[model samples]
Target: MGEENKIILHGTWASLFSKRVELALKVKGIPYEYVEEDLSNKSPLLLKYNPIHKKVPVLVHNGKPVSESLVILEYIDETWKIGSLILPEDPHERAGVRFWANFIDQHVLLSVAKIWKSTGEEQEKAQEEVLEKMRILEEGMKSTNLEICANDLGLLQILLLTTFGSFKAYEEVLGVKVLVQENTPLLYSCVTSLNELPVVKEICPPHDKLVALLNIYRQNAFKSTTN
Candidate 1:
């Protein structure tokens, strides 16, 4: 492929959204250059590529920018059709995946953010919400029979992988266990199984490193609040 035709991912290492794009590219066996961005001082390329959000996980394919993690995943799946399909071929199944993926994005992610960024009564409420959401997700996974299959890792699994990876960081900072075996056996199994995938294992940041980062982030958040 020509240089211009090559894929270039602009993302931050600490960002779970960025990791989603990285996982998709690796799973598809797409060769790409990664440009790590410092969110404190984002690169010009990221600004130029994603002027609207100005966020990490901007995928520049053939010099065309695709922003947002879920959008980037779908773009990769459609662009590189030879790899594992991110969505099922059946329309009903695809819709179901999209629905649950949106649920995670909207509900679960917001709850996690609240838990990490709040304290006292607010944090307590967020913690309860997180557990409730996980319970719902656990039941949903059981109903759908979602597992980490080698040949069919759908978009929902990818989203869950990112969510679960971030959950470790939040769990450490918040002093909570969201994915215990007894509470969420199926979802816990899925997380463990996905973490072992070569593509996922290669891209996921170390657990300790992520926890450290979350600690710093929580401290900064607290300082800002008190000040």
Candidate 2:
């Protein structure tokens, strides 16, 4: 393929999965057009390309579509070998990184999503699960303190940033309140550590915005049940 046949990404700005792909491309110095998507009414192109998951962070290289954020990251790393590499060169190290990445998606992302979407007792239960999961992440970070891999960010740091970003949304959209020192101190510490990093500080979302968003969701959820 020629220079004009470069990759194109379809995703949403608020989506962590989409953010992952964007960060991977930015780290690799890969230039590609970005198409913001509305998952509520997905674009025909998105449905056509990623018919399986039909999710964002779909990468099209030379018109070939690759869905799933992690899969797309691997594609970007393999296709463009310049700048920072996503996976480690060592096979064992690479496996470790992959393991955490998957863990973030399954354990953190999954639980946090429920925190935002559920309400009443359901929401409370989900919050309990989130606190437990955050504890697990906090322990992992304390134990390994994984070395910075690419772009001065470690595997745990990336997971923390992405997972916290999602939690910020939950705290913003749902009335289920969370205080750093009160509810989940370890998770709060995790967020503080990740925020201290220069690169992460630039990429992550603001706390105020998350809180404001959560207020709106809470009001809406209240109205839905009451009225």
Clashing pairs in 2: 172-213, 172-214, 173-214
**Model 1 global lDDT (CA atoms, 0 to 1):** 0.81
lDDT of 2 by residue, 1-227 (tens): 37567788998866677877776676566778889898889999999999988889899988899998778878777777787667778887788778777777888678866765677899899888877776665566456654532235434445555656455455555666543446567656656665565555555666676567557656766667667
TM-score of every candidate relative to the true structure: 0.92, 0.75
lDDT value, residue 164 of candidate 2: 66
**Each candidate: what lDDT?**
0.81, 0.69
**What's the CA error at residue 11 for candidate 1, in Å?**
0.4
**How far out, in Å, is residue 41 in model 2?**
3.2
On residues 1-227, what C-alpha lDDT tens digit does candidate 1 reach at each position?
A: 67767889998887889988888888788889999999999888999999999998899988899999988888888888877888777888777788788989999888877776788888888778987898897788668766543435678778878878556666777787656677777677777787777777798888798889889988887777779
